[model samples]
Target chain A: MKIDTEKLLMIPGPTMVPAEVLNAMALPIIGHRTGEFGELLVDTTEKMKKVFQTKNDTFIITGSGTAAMDMAILNVIDKGDKVLNIVNGNFGDRFAKITLAYKGESIKLENEWGDMAEPEAVKEILDKHDDIKAVTIVHNETSTGARNPIKDIGEIVKDYDALYIVDTVSSLGGDYVDVDKFNIDICVTGSQKCLAAPPGLSAITVSEKAWEVIEKTEKKSLYLDLEEYKKKYNEKKQTPYTPAVSLIYALNVALDLVLEEGLENRFKRHEKLAKATTAGLEAMGIELFAKERARSVTVTSAYLPKGVKDKEFRGLLSKKYNVVIAGGQAHLTGKIFRIGHMGTAKEIHILATLGAIEMALKELGVKVENGVEVAEEILMG
Target chain B: MKIDTEKLLMIPGPTMVPAEVLNAMALPIIGHRTGEFGELLVDTTEKMKKVFQTKNDTFIITGSGTAAMDMAILNVIDKGDKVLNIVNGNFGDRFAKITLAYKGESIKLENEWGDMAEPEAVKEILDKHDDIKAVTIVHNETSTGARNPIKDIGEIVKDYDALYIVDTVSSLGGDYVDVDKFNIDICVTGSQKCLAAPPGLSAITVSEKAWEVIEKTEKKSLYLDLEEYKKKYNEKKQTPYTPAVSLIYALNVALDLVLEEGLENRFKRHEKLAKATTAGLEAMGIELFAKERARSVTVTSAYLPKGVKDKEFRGLLSKKYNVVIAGGQAHLTGKIFRIGHMGTAKEIHILATLGAIEMALKELGVKVENGVEVAEEILMG
Candidate 1:
């Protein structure tokens, strides 16, 4: 199957990588055990720390973001340890499920699908369960397109002695995350999301406090061992196993682009795109699924129009307009559609995506007009 | 630490990828959930079955060969299941470690590092432990360059009720292994080795009986679950998690190359290179590490000259001659070196590699001569 290479990809993760990063990946692959790859690994780790906004040691593991999330849970918490899991969406609930899978006791504080994780609810739970060993939360819920109040949650957790672990799989480079200031013990981000590289590598940062806990626990898994990574990074700046070398090369180029654009400007770009896309959808008489304050900057989620079918509308956009967007996951499927604006997308691309949606809506007999103009107005301002 | 990109990669895994395969990987990234990617995944799976010599389900997982090795064990064998692990070298030992990590009871059948797993030895162990749930072995041990008699071992294993799983990580596409005829229940291979793709993906073929065992077992992992892959493949031909899309594209092209060359011809090519390499090393008065009958066709292992240091000799080849070979791993480190002649390397490349070693040995005052001539004589015949 030949890919439509010219299509504008607007998925939530695996967002469009720039030509420069793609070119970097096309370069010849070096041996992973060689000094050349070791140097690249070290340089990528240093740059990843800048992107993660932490002074902690950063390591890249050869798997998806879920691997990093699993490692974070399996390494720190032993069986039967009490973990306060904040669940607002699919990813948040996944943390709770992973805790259960590893035989940990999870005290779940679940909110509605589109609701942001509230600090007061978390504080109330922590007040009741003082034996909580770790507080697990998703900073940005990918399934519902809601940005939880992790800074406030982090502040509340610091009052207690629970280790704060955050999954920023959909945020990191596109959104602002101060890992050190937020008192986060473990932070996880994926390569395909805001990093704008290909999928397969996950970057993680571990604070000193988390390492102490990890040092005391036996390894639950040989594949996702944190101590193995720590030993390899400290001694040789190499991974314990063979890594995805070409993906690392792409990530190095992607991180350089992130630094070149400056973090604040990149965050502003994501915010602007989110606002423009949301305004365009609202002008078409559609309501956003996420609450106003909790709307994610990387992707904008909205309810489908009364007459439009989710699959048909998405098919028309992809086949005819060459604009591929993401559908809702889990329970939100067919109820909502997501417009991703993370990494490498600009004002013009956002306008084009809105125009394609408008055309698809017209074809589906939904009364909508001037969507591109609405988006352009917000983007220009 | 920029790589000498022009150098020939002669390592066991991550061998030289053909230009066509490299170009396929350079293609633009596509969404994992897209129909385009689904078609590619389906096509690749079908072609992988042909290469694996199996009629069972083949899965493309987004990790190293070790992930496939890990999955083969984690999926079928539950905790406390008795497994007879045949230990010939490092990878064979790793399979036992994985079994123990997952709380399984393992009975090890030991052999020396550079020796093959004898069929008689395996039969003896199985007779003693008739209650063994599974038998794990490696077709080709990458570290020791020893190819075990898996076909013979498989004949002995068919008498028992134990499931037979084999790791063909370094030998799948380049060597001969009839998965069905050998009674192999599960076989694991990597894209980077004899398949001639970049390192990131592992393909595994599972028989119907193995799937029955997997269906009855509870999920031990979310990532490496074979049932999850089977469910996704049957329903929509999609991976349950985000995959390395670019690597899969490369694998598709590499498999096409393998089929075009014909399986028998590819196996003959590997055998020819192995013979030529062995003839060249012997002419230089170097002894092969592995026994004569057990030497691997993909990589040739030889003891380093008495007066020459492994590092200095390998460094001279890489730095001056632009030919990168592999040093010994684990217990054999500094004692032996390896030369790989797997996928995409031709007879001329083998002669060139032998010439590089000859020049390097002369620089190290080893007095080795006519290495390239000896290799050419064998290749011509």
Candidate 2:
């Protein structure tokens, strides 16, 4: 409702939020301890359970996606516990780092960026390490635009004694993720990513198994302790601390849109968009950075065209066309750029992004052709 | 702009936000890594320095007031260090608890809930315990509606080797606190408080002295680590993690309003309103909970009328009059109620709140007279 319609936001997370969701967030401040706020929070949690596709207890944290990951790890694992971290990208490695921060021993099952973690590899590690307390994995790796095989790995983890933790920060709403079916003990996602809400809130669902682990572990950080969160939520349907009330309102509205569209349909729409985006970039003679079968539906990663500098190309899109996209992170920086197509994004948005890229590349004297047409063809099909 | 203005929000922290701030938040989110967002963040930090009254590095975090306090402690103290905690209310005690959670020893100088922490007492403790690494104090205690003597304590702490950490969650924008003059090493506040912005974001100012300690301490949390925050901020003027962009945008606008009004005028306005509220309640034959000189300008804590039921009185105000007020917490529940008049709250709003309370009390068979008239008279002056 208050958005500047001129500039289009296409970042992976902090994706383009719908006007309806923005309007919901724009609603006035409510007392966090009031019955009205409690009722609102309870209702929103119920809706979030449906989005998460889980019967487990869901709680909201007033922080970024990384904070959710911290909660999932810090609550379940105690100091000196051995945790298996499956790393394919930046966020996965962050899981190991967080575990280490909590004094847990992180045994990382490493994979290359833009590659998926194999179920067999995870099975081998779990079989070898019977004392592992928990296993952390990223469902969708935004850093390299890769989607890990969470369901396959979840099936393997279900048979093990270790608690299964999944980070679905970039995929939850846009991709197919049934938390219960995936045998997830703790599933984490952020409001800014596929939920089409602003950043600063993370939605996390916890299973009974995770709670058992949490009960045994000492509270690590006061603000992030999940036991405190659960107790406060169960008693009064309120968070242990003050939450981002406006963002919660926005998330509820965004979840309404997701449910209205239907989860399966939303997943299919994202899949189609991902396909179109990949096909268009390929048609433009640009190579996608992600390996086949591991690419993400929410974001598409690709190498920059020859002669087109990363900054110059991105600047052209932002400054000239009023379209903004993200560049690569960490080791991939300057070599690639990523275009996000999640949460309120449509075929037109995808086509427009490609068209702008095509024009920008031409201005830079890079040889590229029919990017928009190729994207439109794929989207139509 | 989307608020149900009929139901006034008169609560400490998550205070009523202005229409302009809300509208600014509702605007479309931009990429966090974009030049535009970086410029916005830099400009906001500059404006925030004016509010904080310091040349220190101020970083915005995505969490409540407690998280900022957690950051202040976790980043400065290592394991097995001694810290002095000044406890007057719930939040002050929480600082000690956090210090203990990090394995630091906390020596508490306790005060009654409604009483203020004495600077001389702190100096005595410092005199006794020269090994104390840091001293944590609360500028405004929301639970008891009391304001501590931060400037006085700051003067004492400046002579010592300990870091002076102040929690200004409920007082920052409404009260006078010069961080530089007060020798505050780490000063923290939340967006939902007197800033008149939404929750889920905290603005914390870290002095060079505090940073020196943080540099030596091992990282406690990946999410709340100020050292990581400073590095990323210094490199690109961006947070290490994705921030609540909408809330930041809203905070920038809210800070604009605060600066436009002038800090001195804002503090005077809060003082006058606080006096009016207290006078009006006393005129209605209700007693104020906070001590005379230590009363908070943002919130007023008061004893319920003899025959009035806490739930029944509050229920009538919400259901019948469409107004909301807060009841006391922990041991003070059912004994007192709190009325918040911070951020975007005007004299007319205070008059309306008192009028509603007067009407509710009358319905409950409590004889009350001239409550609104008294408030109006004080406000008129």
Best by DockQ: 2
lDDT of 1 by residue, A1-381 (tens): 476799989889788888777766666767888887789999999999999889997889888888888888988888799999899888888889888878899999988888788899999999998899899999888888899988888989989888999999999999999999999999998999988888888978999999989998766667777888889878877898778887888889899999999999999999999999998888877788999989999988999988678899899999999999999988888999988889878998898999899888988988886778888888988
Overall lDDT per candidate, in order of appearance:
0.87, 0.89
Interface RMSD of each: 1.5, 2.8
Number of the top candidate by lDDT? 2
Name every residue pair that clashes in candidate 2.
A3-B28, A28-B3, B14-B192
For candidate 1, lDDT tens digit of each residue in B1-381?
244579888888788888777777667789999889899999999999999888989899888888888888888777799999988788899999889877889899989878887899888889988789889999998888899999999999988888899999999989998899999999998888899888888989999878888887766676777887999989988998889887888889989999999999999999999999999989988889998879999988999989789989999999999888999988889999988889877898898899899999988898885877888887998
lDDT of 2 at B292: 92
In model 2, where do residues sit more than 4 Å from their true spots? A1-5, B1-5
Q: Model 2, range A178-260, lDDT digits (tens) per residue?
A: 99999999999999988888888998999998888889987678999888888999898899899998998898888889999
Residue-level lDDT tens digits of model 2 in B192-283 = 88889888888899998888888899877899988788888889888888899988889889899999999999999999999999999999
Residue B22, model 1: lDDT of 75
Clash count, one per candidate? 0, 3
